[model samples]
Target: MFDLSKEFESFYKNKVVLPNDKQNDLREKKNLNISRLKDGLNEYNEENKTDYKIINTIVQGSMAMHTVVQNDSNDYDIDVAIIFEKENLNDKGPLAVRNIVTNALKRKCENFKKEPEVKTNCVRIEYQDGYHVDFAIYRRYKKENESEYTYEHAGSEWTLRDPKAINNWFKDEIKDKGQCLRKVIRFSKMFCKSRDYWVNMPGGLIQTVLCDEKIQNSYERIDEIFYHTMVEVKNRLDNDINVYNPTDTSLSLLSTKDHEKKVENFKNKLNDKLKKLDVLFESDCDKSKAKNAWYEFFNHDYWKEDTSNEKVQKYSSCYRNTEEFIEDLVNINEQYYVTVSCNVEANGFRLQPIKKLLRSLPKGWLPHGFSIKFNVEDTNVPKPYNIWWKVRNVGEIAQKRDMIRGQIEKHVGNCKQEHSDFFGNHYVECYIIKDNVCVAIDHIDVPIE
Candidate 1:
């Protein structure tokens, strides 16, 4: 009666530490290979003489930043972006340029009796052990009124630079090329032990954006965004708390340390306020009593103004409702993950500890013979979705579910969304991918309002 699934996952993480030397070495070898391949491209370019030029050569991802190296023992891969330029919109000018390079590299590697480790474009090359090289092509630009107007290869986005302006906006931060890559590497490691999550999630666009000094350096409109994000994650995780902790001693408990710190900080900040308040010694009799106290405190003009007007209010707006009587299962993802899907898109689900929410939400204020009404909200379908929940402690998980469904049904009598029975199996779609390859990981919740 062993759960093989959990066992394998535990084994995989323990085995992964850091990428060995083989991780970076293939990058070195790839340089030699690219050099050899480039020689042939130059010959082809000279023969064609079509006036195409290599505009920029950028090395992106872990290898480029050097945080991760090539390890022969582990699976390592490298990526390269080779950018160039051409004129005709209809004709395949750059594609030809790309073809010559890719074809030449393919031919050279063919002697090894294998197709080149690559994709369609010549600028992009994949190396052994999960690394790749991307070649970027810059379309030819035109000089307009003393300004150089260069559109991206795709032509949808264009860059117009003033000749005199080198825009060292990040000059203080990204002084040199290596520093830029190093910063990126440091940020990339923040998300994963190395890049395993990137493989599981794939499309490391979030890492790239976080590494960009320009964005990091920007101070305007920053605080405004961060506060809202915290509350959003908290609110969403409050629901769908179905994640299990196995109640086993061997495995660690949910990361209560972080949660402890947060709660402690709040308690400390509120200590003085609690002291001056009249009901400091109020006993925990029922959730209903606590709810009454909290409501009374907030409803008072002085207390409301002190809290309701502050920036933290945005995040704290729903704090009481979320933690009132509920224990939740939270999925902490890499910074990039939360960055994109953010508010509604962060992944993982919370298991309501349904019974706990019911009993606790009442805050010790349960009326023994009271009947509860239930209703549903139409916005619960998922992202672009938000939920307002309060787990007023009911007796049992089954009882709580029934109570909540009844309440929601009363709330949504005309919404056409049915008052439904609880299904044992469900997947919470916290985050989703829209247009971009990057994902929006989300969570599920079963909240009582």
Candidate 2:
């Protein structure tokens, strides 16, 4: 491909990434608004004789991940997680809690052009400028005999969500690789949000996940790496549009109808744009053609200028060979999905659901003699299919004790029972095989602390 590494880098700095000055200004604005919220709530408490207290605040979304890009419309969305004690809510439902927070935000802010509105999941305050702040209200409480606190968001219902899970996942990714992946994510976001006509593009978190999965950094030039990575992402989406959350595999990021449509739109548009860039890899491609291709792709004016006269190198895409897992060996035709749930018991006394314990307990620890029973709750697949289960244990203790059991076994029924003997990040996967092809599959994590 024509070497546009210099051009890509320049465009990234001048157009794609947010400027340092703007970043600083946004930070100041965010801090000021947060302070106003806290003060307003305090005043509300004093007058109403209520004891609502702010336990913690967390910054999430693209801003926390540092993958924010410049927008043509100058519209910015800032997310802040506001945590409160469970007693403060007094058993109020989701909408009531949101209204309480919205009333608090509307108390004494002079700069607000409009009053704060209560959405389904958050309280939104819009400024005179294009910036809007969303305060996601959550309640925290410690379970009995557990050291860690459980956080649940006041959405349509009380939904369990770890406020720092996705942020920590992205931070770990950056630590393992480097800033190059962040840059690639920014470039991908710029392309996704380039045109005004394109509606319902995938949001920053989904884009970040896609880039993290498909990024190829072996190439020296940034342009070449981005091109190949985007192509790989497009190809993957062509088969399956479902995107599972990395931290919690059971949670689907595209759970809603709107989000599913958004990803479908992104996949189609990305395929069309990547086809135009195929000319760059031709034998007789030059700088002018390459510049036009990228300029049209990003729809940016900075890409119009050409500052390099470097020779074009023959583009040979290099892809890393990932180890094939057992699931990859099968012809996965996921026409349906199976729901897996676990039952927990200690000394013949039943406890809560294992899924709930997994969220509340920090390390997914169970008592010494606890037994677990995994049941296939629901499935739409036809009858007479083979049921297979696999238990994989992973941890330092499991490795040191030589107890890392990871074998697939065939079972006769829908329920499988096992005892928790060691502490590790163990998991069980269930697969439904029909006519020598996997028709449905599901897995549940069993972390032992």
Best by TM-score: 2
Model 1 steric clash total: 76
lDDT by residue (267-334, candidate 1, tens digit) is 33233233332342345333333333333422322222333356655543432221110101211111
TM-score of each: 0.33, 0.67
| Every candidate's CA RMSD | 25.6, 18.2
Candidate 1: residue 345 Cα off by (Å): 63
Tally clashing residue pairs in candidate 2: 0
Error of 2 at 122 (Å): 0.7
Q: Single out the weakest 10-residue window by summed lDDT for candidate 2.
A: 314-323
Show the colliding residue pairs in model 2: none
In terms of lDDT, the best-performing candidate is 2
Residue 323 error, candidate 1, Å: 45
Report the alpha-carbon TM-score of model 1 versus the true structure.
0.33
Off-target runs (Cα >4 Å) in candidate 1 are 1-27, 45-56, 66-77, 87-94, 110-114, 117-123, 128-130, 147-151, 154-199, 208-449
